[model samples]
Target: MTLIYAMPGNELFAELLMQHTGYGRAGLSVHSFPDGETRVTVDTPLKGEQAVLVCSLDRPDPKLWPLAVAASTLRELGARRVILVAAYLAYMRQDARFHPGEAISAKLLGEWLDNHFDALVTVDPHLHRYHSLNQIYSRDARLVHAAGALAAWIASHVERPLLVGPDDESRQWVEAIANLLCAPSVIARKERHGDREVTIHLPELGRWLDHTPVLLDDIIASGQTMLQTLRSVCAYTTPKPVCAAVHGVFAEGALDALRGEGVGDIATTNSIATETAHIDISMQVAEALTAVCNIITERRWG
Candidate 1:
């Protein structure tokens, strides 16, 4: 049988996945040493079972050793396969070395993870430069998109919504959601001044001025683009803007800053497990995991 094991902090989402996929449950424990090393113990016996580890790779520095050792321990315990279901896969943005002597993290981390895990499943990795994850991963890496879940939420929560993308990169998500809901969408242009500073340019609201504007993005890192966009959006007479993203990596007060700018509603998938993670993507994730095991299942927050 396929057993679902949730790394620390992933229990709730993993339970949802287990319920949806009819998968069995497993356990894991970790202990940190004073010297900064980690000890992991697999609590469930799985002599010949496939294991799925739900560990979202956000703020992944401290979690890496626990994850690697857990996977290794599972293998040592005779797990047939150990699949990593990292809903918010990190280190994807740095696809290449922007400067000299820089470590290409995407490749470097991919190799590390590839060696540790049998397969990879994640949702909405920030793949702006490369075509697919296969370039970096040697394992059977699967990607799932959360646009359907976002569109469904918009269709239910808002009326006459106007989907707004932060920049050219968000066109894929904006277009998908717009098409799904049959709503008008517009893409804005963004200029980055620094990590926490950005300038956003939006087209004239024009005839679609009356529609409720929904600010959509794949990731909300420092919230600069979304903040500047929210400021620009507020300048108009449009309804209070709503924010939706697959990964809610609201780095240090980004959510409050948006609220300060008069945001109407903020919803993100449980990829990063924040207060605003109202949208559910567990069923989608279960579907993806089941598919690999020949089980039928459906942003899955890959």
Candidate 2:
């Protein structure tokens, strides 16, 4: 068993973690410094105990500071082992060299955290074609695919839903979710030149588009891709609802931007705690962690 802790930056995340852990003891405290920095303290005794720090890596700049401090302090407090549960992991998109001299930020972030934690757990991490978080982080890093949960939620709410992937990259998720719900799926072609601009193309689906549709994606950093897909689909078909695994990273004015585009309702798995986030994928996250923890325990103690 491990001691679970959460930060003020993500109190709801902490509560969810506690519920999932089924561990009666949960502890956390965070304070802001005069210099605008933050400090966190774990009041419970962590000596020689396994500790699970649950934090959603939303806006990295603000959350990173406290996360670093908390990890270091917990390590110093004699925690025998530390596991990080990041509901949303940032800086994972830069897995490849898009241009010359571009730093592989995802690699750096993974390596940095690799030195601190025993295991990493994240839900629906944005992975590129060439790399994965497990390859980036040396320790056991579990990428929890929430497609099943998302599919189940959609099935419970909507009947005969069509899953639409915003782009080719999201087709994997779209297909997985559709399979889970026993539904059909399609992926749009997306073209992007730079930030804040995108083009999505969807081939005609005719009567299939007339039914309830649920747009799905692994990440929604800027919401541009989704808006483009929504517009493209809406242009030729009837209005359909949209939902995603990770919602509303809502970068910039993405929320308003998407709403302005006539997006009916949006839901996400609490990967980044947005207003559109109506669901929590903590249970899914916990299940992934449990699997990883089991493997590690077997390998270490076998």
Candidate 3:
């Protein structure tokens, strides 16, 4: 098997994956024309070998065409199978149409990738309405959890940690981490008025006043939820709440906004490359990839 990656700030992740899986590395060179056209080149032969493409679809629009070209080119280069390891799968929020004539981008992107890759692996995709990745994707799809790593980080770093979920949607993540650490957990009631405006009703934390509150969530896109929760927690307590997430999609100065709002600390998994990626989830992802490769190998030999 060979790993091929194309993106800035992904070299470290690629190196970690290579070290963990002992997979050969393949080079991919991308050139962009003045007219905004792109040319993708795979610099290594992949004939009779499984090709794994490592890409995190954070800002996915500009990378889509090149990814498509690369995946198709891998098949033409005689790759036995092409597997996609998308650390942070995008367009998952639009799993369903909220309004009439709305396009379901999640399903569309899933179908598009399904047509290209023989298998897919991603970490903590935004699966709101969709129960599983298999519901949207046709290929062999796997979703790896980052909660264990996050929980371990919290247990080691934070003193007397009190896991707090911003809203009901975050209950699963909070409970998982809290249970792992054997700590108390609380969930805030959230009412979304708009994309930027949200009302968070936090549960009473007086019982665990000595414990440091750590707000946990799956994805932090707009930061509205975190901001609201931070303000509410601050109003009632002295210790500033630390905010952490699996995928830190800090969109449009959201990180700045969180910092400005006096959030104690902000950190996230290395799903998308950002300054706040203090916790490493590369081992988790590499383990999943190894498992997937083992399964594929067993099936091929069986």
Candidate 4:
């Protein structure tokens, strides 16, 4: 069973779930009171069935009370099992303590959500150094990378190109794409200050400069790093690079910032829908859900 809440920015996701699981297996609705409190009503029954809740924990909605309440209620509604699909998990940047008395928000969030679901799944969680979310959840958490979908999208349109990793954190994603395309790649470094300022350091591209550069990053919050890197590479390289990311948080005027920076093209996965999200990550997410469902099914009957 699939329980869907009518959250903004999740219509495409809900539709994808329906496409993958068939219409009759899903339920969706939302209820709000006059005093501002909200409630989620699963329009169809979920009793005795494994229920998967599809929600993207994006900005403004990440701390939404109704979603949490809905999650807890699903298990109580006779759902034999509950799984959460946080398409774009927020508060993940604060995974570790960087200051005195500061909360490790990711750890707290992960632990708080641990007991609510039999499994947790997300697409391209903004984990800086961590590749797998199991390290954070310490249980049944799946971090689904959008690489295959991203690669397929690129292959359909892009020609032979050089893949560039925007920073050390993006090496895994960049290398994976490079391997998929059998193309050359390189990694760069950046010093970020707040959400709007960044200084990018690009390494010697050598012969790779002849090929078009496709800069890839996991997230683009303020678009500063991408803009700065694009300018730096354009100034020094022969053929300029296009830019893409898994999540286009694109806070504030980030998209305009990219345009003003003279980026020829920009693409990001639909983890957060934007005019620039030229690619979608749903197929990758569907594959992940299939794997988790299989595991949960096997473990239950094994």
Q: Largest lDDT belongs to which candidate?
A: 1
What does candidate 2's lDDT look like per residue over 133-154, in tens digits?
7788888888877777777778
Q: List the residue pairs that clash in candidate 3.
A: none
Query: What Cα-based lDDT does every candidate model obtain?
Result: 0.87, 0.77, 0.86, 0.76
**What's model 2's overall lDDT?**
0.77
Q: Estimate the TM-score of every prediction.
A: 0.95, 0.92, 0.96, 0.89
In candidate 2, the residue pairs with backbone N, CA or C atoms under 3 Å apart (3 or more residues apart, or in different chains) clash, namely: none
**Which structure is stronger by TM-score: 2 or 4?**
2
Off by over 4 Å in 3: none
Q: 78-127 in candidate 4: lDDT tens per residue?
A: 77777777878888888888889999988877786776767877887877
Q: State the displacement of the C-alpha of residue 227, model 3, in Å, after optimal TM-score superposition.
A: 0.9
lDDT (C-alpha) at residue 8 in model 1 = 92
* Candidate 4 runs further than 4 Å off: 1-6, 23-25, 31-36, 60-63, 129-131, 238-240
Q: Backbone clashes per model, in order?
A: 4, 0, 0, 0
Q: What would the per-residue lDDT of candidate 3 be over residues 1-302, giving only the tens digit for each residue?
A: 65556454467788788888898888887899999999999865656778888888998998788888888988898887888888999999898889999999999998899889988889999888998899899878778899898987887778988888988889889998888889999999999998899999988888988778898999999999998898888877667789999999898989999999888888899998899998898887888888887788778889
Clashing pairs in 1: 122-302, 123-302, 145-299, 146-299
**RMSD, candidate 3, Å:** 1.3
Tell me, by TM-score, which candidate is best.
3
Worst 10 residues of 2 by lDDT: 239-248
Off by over 4 Å in 1: 295-302
Question: What's model 1's lDDT at 6?
Answer: 88
Give the winner by lDDT: 1 or 3.
Answer: 1
Error of 4 at 252 (Å): 1.3
